[model samples]
Target chain A: MIEVRNVSYEYIKNSPVLDDISMTFERGKTYAIFGPSGCGKTTLLSLLGALDAPTSGAVLFDGKDIAQIGDENHRKDNVAFIFQNYNLIEYMTAAENVSLTEKIDPLPYLLQVGLTEDEAKRPVLKLSGGQQQRVAIARALASDAPVILADEPTGNLDEDTAAEITKLLCDVAHENNKCVIIVSHSAAVAEAVDQVVRLSHGKLQEEV
Target chain B: MSIFKRAWTYVSRTRKKTASLCAMMCVMLLLSLVGIMLHGVCMDASQNLKEVLGGYVRLTYSASNDREESVLDEALAAQIAALDGVADYSGISTYYLSAPDVQLVAGSFAGQPQGQVPRFVGCDKSALHENFIYNSFEVIEGRHITSADEHCAVVSDVFANLNGFTVGDRFEACLDSVITQDEAMPEEVYSLEIVGIYTIHEGWEITPMTPERDIAENFIFTDMQTADAVLLAEHGVEKPFYRQGVIFTLNDAERLPEIARSMQNMDGIDWENFELVVNDKAYRDSAASLQMLEKLSLLLVIITFSLSGILLALVLTLWIRERRHEIGILMSLGISKVSIWKQFLLETAIIALVAMVVAMTLSVPCSRMLSEKAFDVAETMAQSQAEEVHDPMADVMEKLNPTADAAVDVVQKDDVHLTFAACITIVLCTAGIITISVTLSAVPMFRMKPKEILSDVN
Candidate 1:
């Protein structure tokens, strides 16, 4: 489980982006962070992924603050991230892109994420938006991290592809015993997850 | 993934950029190789010249003085010979005289008796042979003159041709001096047999103050006994005398002044009538050229580093900026910053290594061309200077000894190695510059937050 305690984040002095907020994300569950634009959904995901520090709070992974656990070691062993717009390296093949996070064989994870052997070997730039998204999902899953933080994972995909991506994330959380956090504005995406949290004006509240 | 795999992936992926970097590295390596090769060649040549020139001492004497009264006396010669670090010493006396009638051609020496104008050279024959001074003589007809042949002489090809004489030819001519009542009286002369004929190689010819004077055609050689005999018969001298000047060859020319001062203070000698001259110009010129090369090499190295650094910085800066999105994606995926940095550095090192190998391979021709050009310029200048002075060919021939010949063997091999090492050094230096520049450009990325890197993409 990942825990946030009185977390506040600021880009500049006295200009906070995330106000005092506390939340818990349990293992073996898919959680969605739904918010309007500029509601700090992405900032929350970044902190959870250990990409940044909180201004005055604790981000805990398994009862230990992620910051005190060492940023590099925490990121390397505990979390994975998937970005919107399919952030696959253009120069690398889909399989190579997926392998960027994996400590072992990436081909099986690529197949698990629904990429054919030949399609996975093609350069990521040559793949369609939907296929690229799957590759990013493969990369995150291959990391074998306990927690996955994804920001707008299906932002660039069509409805069918978005549904497939959401299903994949839900399956990974429930079947693989992982905690998955999806930050998105899409209501469809939020409804597909096991739990949903609504964020507004730098504050978080549980949804009914 | 392993660092090797990552490095290989980046290298294979960015073919165009890698190739461009390699090309730049090759050029730098080639320049360095050429510079090193030329420096080696110049140093070798200078050393050879110094050894051949016998440490920069000139032999000179006054023409008006008699042989016995000259500085070439046995006592002074012995004193100089015994001086510290004196390699060897020899006293040589030379003058001109007419050939005998039987040996004389119609236009030779204005039809005087074949004057045995012998030069009195007092020297150890073994030292002269070891130095290769006498070895330069190519005996086309008969044998060389030995100390055993006190009266025998070696005649040059030019002298033999003008006199209509051959080896073993004995001739006699009048020694009578014509008396000009109001002017001067003619001196007596002697007859001698030509025992040998020799010719000097073209490169060995010495250019005299008079452009038309050829030493081979004009001079005849014999021992001091013959020279003393001729002087006595013609000028009526009994005791042996010498001219005012003496030429000393020492182990080190830098010690000449001290040695000269010591000689000047010797008992019963006239110091004001003579001056000592050390031929140190060759050494001085070589030293100056070496100093200039050192300065120029330093400047070139600094310029190369500065220029390459700026270029590399610009390339890395733009490249890293373009990869911001990738950096954010990778960091978010749990790739450590240090690994990211290593990947970038590895990519550059691969590019630089490939470039260095190519540059080294290409530098063979480049270094050869540069060395040849430098040699040509040196040769031309040496030739022009030779033309302005005394017989340049003779000067070169006299100086071409065993020491220089041995030095040449060493130079050819060492010069090539030196050039290759220089090329390697330059390439390594270029690699260092690239590393520093890349590291500097990567610093800003380390401080950036993942959101900041990803915001642009959003």
Candidate 2:
């Protein structure tokens, strides 16, 4: 579970990217943050991942303020992130990329994300875009964190591949007791998750 | 992960950069090695020369213009020898010899006679002897004049060969002054036999007084009795002559001036006709050379560090810039800024260590070669200067007759060794350069925010 109370962020003062935003999500559920470009969706994901702290108010995880948990350890032990470009280390193989934290065997998680053993061993650069995305997902899963924040996770894949990635994310949330929050502009990606939180003009509104 | 593993991974990934760093290190190390070797050789040469040249003072009597002018007597020589700080003392007497101007003749002094020549020296017999300071002479053939033999003489091998004389061969020598009809006036000619031959072979040509006078190749050595007899015969005098001066080798060179000053003021001595000269100019020259070596070594270290710093900085800056994405990823993975900085430093330190080992291995032979070349150049220059001063034609003529000359004995040879302290200094300097370069290169990486780095890459 996570909560945002009157949170605002700006890279520079007088130029706000997120303004007075408030939201909450329950545990063991997938939430899709749907927004057009420049709606602070990625900023919200970064805040949730503890990569950056909100300038005012708080972003809370499991009813405790993340700012109090120490950002580095908080990110290390509690949350994992998947980026739009599937930021796998280019120098490493798929398995190494998936086990970025090196905390567990990434093969089982890669298999759960629909990658063959041979594919997992190959360099991530040699993999298809959808396969690389699955490897990124496997990395997040392998971290054993309860929360996964994916920013535009299916942005580079075809419709069928995007659907498969969306199903994989949903399966991780429902079957693995994870809170999977995906920030996306795609309507199909939003429909695949358990719930949607629409963000526009620095405000969050829940949609049925 | 271990720092060593991280360092190895980075170094393995950047093979080209590692190679370039190694080359630079090798060059720097070679220069430092050359500096160290030169310093060692210069110091060794100085110490060798000092050991061979005895102490600093060259004590001798001043020439008398009047009969009343006093020469050093036995009592005076004894008194001076009793002075404190006197390490050793010796006396020598020299006289010109008339011999046959023969070519390729040996074992006999039979040929056409040459005119009498002038010879200058101090007599070493009775109280003071030559063996006390035998290092001043080099014997190429036969042996040194150890006792006061009335019939024995040690002639230089160069003079003996030119005049066709050998060991045990008899030859006639004349004194500088001979007594004529006038009892008050003395003439300069007498005859004696040669018994031994010595050589001065430092290879440095002796400078001549005139273009036509020819630098003398003739050298003769004899006991004080034979020398005294030859002088008595040349002067035609019945009165015994005492030595003009006593040569003292002091226990320490620093005491030379003090002892000389004290001897100048001793009672029963003629201060006007007696002078003490500390022959420390050679020591001064060697000291100057040592100082120059120190300056050159310091300059070399400065140049090595300055150039290495700039080069390492440029290369490491590019390396750090190339790894910006990795830095961002690591930072985002919750690796602390300090840890990231440490990794980069560890990488450079590993590469530098390998380079230092390789460079040190190569420098030994390279430094030796450089030292040999430098010594050769110095020797060549000394030879050329000697040649310019004493032309070969004049040298040959002087070889027939030597007069009013001071012979130099060369005993020291070339031997140099590198020291542990010097090697340590070189390694420390190299490590310092790397530390500074690493710190400077990491500045940009440390200044960046993780999000900024990631966004820039994206």
Candidate 3:
């Protein structure tokens, strides 16, 4: 489980992007942070991903402060990020990108993500937007990290492709017993998740 | 994936950027290598010119001067000869005398009957005389006069032929008769043995009125000690009273001033009556051009290094900026900034190694051709100016003190070789340039956080 305890962040001195926000995400469940464009959903996800520090309070993984675990170690061993636009290493093949963590054989994960053997061996940039998202999903799944953070992972994909990518994230959460946190502004994306936390003005407005 | 594999993949996949970087490095390294080689060649040529020209320093003691006479003794002569870079030295004194029984060679167009006097040139070593140094006279038979020889002379082949004289023959010469016309001074005629015969070169006669004493064939070479004895017998003077003083021939004329300064600092030397004359004017035309080339080559090296550094820095800065997206991707994948930096460094090292090899291949022949062209220009420049800057005063000094200020011919040819030291210096410089450029270019990239970098990627 990952916990955010009164975590507050600010880009500038007097303005808060995430103000004293608290949340809990358990393993074997898919959760969506649903908010409008400037609601600080992504900032909360970045704090959980250990990409940046909070202005006040703490983010903890399994009751221990994430800062104590070290940001690089937490990112490397605890969380795998799936960014918008696929975020694939352009020079590498899909299989190479999947095996970047070097912790697992990427073929199985790539096949599970619905890519063919031939598509897995091709450079990621040569694939379509949907196929590229599948590669990003395979890369996140092949990592040994216990948490998966996807920030608008399917924003660039079509409707059907986005649904497919969302389903794959839910499958990774349930089948691999991992915590999956997806930050998105779409109501359709929030509908499929196990829980939805609606954020407004850097605070949790509602939870369902 | 390992950093090495990542770096290799980027270098191989990005063919255009890799080639561009390699080409820029090649241009920089090639010019630097050539500049280093040219600078080394110029320095070597300068040293060789000094050795070939072989300037001399003459220490003269003048009685007419206001300062106390610093008479040169045997001990002082030995000390000056022992100075560094001194190749040889000679104590010379000139005398005019007439050999009554012997027939002296006349000028090409003998004008005055009073030109019957022959010049007896006395020296510690006749082989170091200016006539031999300038190739004006060469001993064809017998041997040259040395300090060990007593009352011995080396006459020209023309005079020997006219007098039917040979080596081991004796002749009677009287300096008192020529100096004072004193028939009452016991007719101090000295019997001098002929030890050598020499052949004079053409163009020795300056004009029809050239005195027999000025004629090359009428010049007799003998020992300084013998001439001092004759002077003591005639005017009652002691030994070591050298009229023309002593000339120290240096191995390298470029060190003449240094040796002169050192000589002046020696103990018991009179500053006013004593004079140290350094004569390298004959070599000035050639040495000047070589020195100028040396300075120019040094400037070339400085410019090459500066421009190469600036160009490499600019190229690398653009290269790193173009890869900011890649850097963000790698950083988000849990790779440390240090690892990313290592990848970039590896890429640069690969390209720079290839470029250095190519530069080394091209530099050898290119530097050789460039140095040869520079030398040819220097030679032509020296020759053209040598025709205009004839120093008659130096020539007169040479005749008066034969070993001092002897004209030396400029070396016409020199070959450039790449030295190990120069190669090492160039390699170090290239590595330094690459390292600094990479560090400077990477500064902006390293300063950004992974979040900032990823957000900027579009």
Give the winner by TM-score. Answer: 1
Candidate closer to the true structure by TM-score (higher is better), 2 or 3? 3
Sorting all predicted structures by DockQ, with the top scorer first, yields 1, 3, 2
For model 3 the interface RMSD, in Å, equals 1.4
Q: After superposition, how far is residue A14 of candidate 3 from its true place, in Å?
A: 5.1
Q: Give per-residue CA lDDT, model 1, range B18-63, as digits (tens).
A: 7876677667655655555556556555555445444424334445
Report how far off residue B76 is in candidate 2 (Å). Answer: 6.9
Q: Which stretches of candidate 1 lie over 4 Å from their true place?
A: B53-55, B59-70, B73-122, B125-270, B282-298, B379-424, B456-458
Instruction: Give Cα distance to truth, residue B73, candidate 1, Å.
Output: 5.1
lDDT of all the models against the reference?
Answer: 0.65, 0.64, 0.79
The superposed Cα distance between candidate 3 and the true structure at residue A26, in angstroms, equals 1.9
Candidate achieving higher lDDT, 1 or 2: 1
- Sort by lDDT, top down from the best: 3, 1, 2
The DockQ figures for the candidates are 0.58, 0.35, 0.44
Q: Tens-digit lDDT track for model 3 on B34-107?
A: 88888887787677667655677888875556323456666778887887888998887888766667787665
Residue range A121-188, candidate 1, lDDT tens digits: 89888888878988888888887788998889988788887888789899999999999999988889
| DockQ value of candidate 1 | 0.58
TM-score order of candidates, top first: 1, 3, 2
Comparing 2 with 3 on lDDT, the higher-scoring candidate is 3
